[model samples]
Structures are given as C-alpha cells and as structure tokens.
Target: MLSTKTLFARTVQTTARRALGTTTTRGKHTVPDLDYDYNELEPVISAKIMQLHHDKHHATYVANLNVAEEKLHEAQAKGDVAAQVALQPAINFNGGGHVNHTIFWKNLIGEKNGGGQLHDGVLKSAIENKYGSLDKLQQVVNGKTAGIFGSGWGWLTVNPSGQLDVVTTANQDMPSNIGHIPLLGVDAWEHAYYLDYNNVKADYFKNIWRVINWKDVARRYDEAMSKF
Candidate 1:
C-alpha cells in the first residue's frame, strides 16, 4: 500500500483538479428560448411587448445574474462576509428576475389553445377550497395587483399546509423564499404591459388571463401536492 502522506497528497491533487475544472466550466448564461412565438397570444399580449420583454428585459436579468454569482463566488473565496452580505441584494434581484421570468414565459400560451380555462382537477379543487371559487381567487389576485404602488408581482401561492393564497411582492421578491410555493405569478411591472395596455394595468391583468397556461398552473399544483 502507498504511504499515508503520499495517498493524502494524491487525494488533495484530485480534489484540486475537480475544483479547477468547475471554475473553468463557468460560462455565459444564455436566455431560455420561448416555446411559442411572439404574437401567439395576440389580443391579450402584443407581439411587440413579448419580443421586448423577452429579448431585452429578461436577457438583462440573466446577464446580471451571471455577474452577481461571479461576484458572490469571489467574496466567498475571500471569506468576506460583509462583501457577501452586500452582494445579497444583487443576488436576490437578479436571481428572482431570472426565476420569475423563466416561469412567466412558460405560464403563457397561444390563443389557439384553451389557454385560460381550468378544468376539473386538483387545481380546481384547491382554488375552490381556498377562495370559494376560481372567480373569487381572480378577483383577489387582480385587486392585489392593482393595489401595488409600483413595480411588483402578484402571485397565487400554496402554503405548506396545502392552502392557496394570493400575495403580492414589491419588485422581484419571490414567494418561495418566504415559505410559500408559487402556483401562478402575474407580472405587474410597467414594462410587462406598457406597450400594449399603457397606464391601464388593471385592464392588462384582466385581459392577460385569456392566455394564461392553466395546464402549467395545474401541473404546479399537482407537484406541490405530491411533495406533501
């Protein structure tokens, strides 16, 4: 058998190689491609708005997330807790942006499909149980979205107890971090609807429902239920 010291040296070298490989593998983050084309949800969301939101706004978030992660790694390597804490906001903002947009893109569907209808299932039951009916849930969510003073998100979330809720967060804060699993999220930022709806955010919220991918929301509800 090899001497203990020699074996330890070899193990250290192997670990170093793995670490170096991981560092070298870090690469530019790419924007996720949409499953549907712009204009696919026309009449609810305009093609021009979709293109700009995905190509310009969401891309910026992905790029910034990469930069923030790199800075976080640098701070961690230096053992600088203060620097790490200072970078937390950058991490949260960009990370939340990246995450929320990723879900938002998939949560929409083409008008050709039965986009907004929620058929009978766990999702329907959950909504009925929590809000008395789907209409009530929508009313609460829309009202909350309208009440937001500035850019933020309105969400339907499932708590650990399997109860559904409507909650709004300022800016890009995610509901998951606060112990709720997001079932559906509506982006209320001016950029999300300004091109099509202008200053009428409530109108946008109400109209956008026509293209909501209830299939995705149902799947999320099912998955959340399974985890319990």
Candidate 2:
C-alpha cells in the first residue's frame, strides 16, 4: 500500500489536473443539436420558424457569448474593472439566450411521439394541485405569456419553496436569476412566432401546447425536487 503522504500527493495531482481541464474547456458554448428535425413541429410552430430560431438566432447567441467571454477574460487578466463591467450585459444576454434556447429545444417534440400527452404522475399532480388541471395550467401560462410587453419568456418553474409557479422574464433574462428552477418555457420574442402567427401572440401560445414535451418537463421537475 502507498504511504499516506504519497496517496495525498497523487490525490492533489489528480484534482489539479481536473481544475486545469475545466478552466481550459470553459466558456466554449455550442448550439445543442435537436433530436427531431426542424420540420417536425410543423402546423404549430412551422418549419420556417424552427429553422430560423434554432439555426440563426440560437447559433448567434452561442457565437456572441464566446466572443464576450474571451474579452471578459482578457479584462480580468489586466484587472480592468470598467472593461469587465461593460462586458456584463453582453454576457448575460447571450448566456441566457444560450441557456434558455437549450431548454426550449428539449421542451418541444412532434405530436406523433405523444408530445402533448401528460399522463398521471407527480408532475401532473403538481399541476393539478397548483392550477386545478393541466388545461387550466395551460390557460394560466397563456394568459401570463400574452401579457408580456415585449421580447421575453414565460416559464413554469420550481420556486424556492419547491412549489410549481408561473414566472416571466423579459429580454432573454433567465429564470434562475430569480431563484427559480425552470421546468418549461415559451418564447415570447417576435422571432419565435413572426413567420407563423403574424402579430397574434396569443395564437402562438395556444398552439405551442400541442408540441410541448411534457415528459421533459416532468423529468426536470423530478430533478429539481431531488435538490430541494
């Protein structure tokens, strides 16, 4: 058996390697590939909308985020607080866009794969308890989503108390910024519905439910519960 000092040295070396690996790989954001084709969510979101939203919009966020982080790192290395402060908004916007869009993609599915189906389970039960039923929950979500003044997101989050709650974040802000664990989100930005719904945001909210991936929401709910 190795001596205690030798074991300690090996452990320290291993931890140092992990820390360096993490630092080297940090801030290299990439657009997450979707499981279904962009056309798969048609009749609700439309192929054109999905194509632009995923390919152009989300990819731009990932690219800009990488650039902003690189600049920020340089600022930090030189101890330039003003430069770091100036970079803050870009980091938050692009970072939140990346995070939100990643979740948004997973929260969607084609209707053929039981996309809108919400079977009996803890997640369903939680919805029922909170808003009386899943349909009511959708109604609530739609009402809240429609009222968003501009580009924003509607989210069903696990609040700090671990209860199901509805919240809205404006202009690419993330739900986590408000101490909520997002379970589902709907984009209210015009780009998300402009090609399809035209100016009618309510229609987009109503139709999006048909393509919602409830299974993914349920999985997120379970995981959030595990933490709190």
TM-score, cand. 2: 0.89
lDDT for each of the candidates? 0.79, 0.84
* lDDT per residue (tens digit) for residues 1-228 in model 1: 986545544443333223222231223556799999998899899899999999999999878867866775676566555666666676567767877888789888976887888899988987888789878888999999999988999998888677788888889887776768887899999999998888888899898788889999999888888888
> Which ranges in model 1 have alpha carbons more than 4 Å from their true place?
1-28
Output candidate 1 Cα RMSD: 7.6
Best-fitting candidate, scored by TM-score: 2
Q: In model 2, what is the error at residue 148, expressed in angstroms?
A: 0.8
Q: Per-residue lDDT for 49-81 in model 2, tens only?
A: 898999999999989878877886677567665
Q: Against the true structure, candidate 1 has what lDDT? A: 0.79
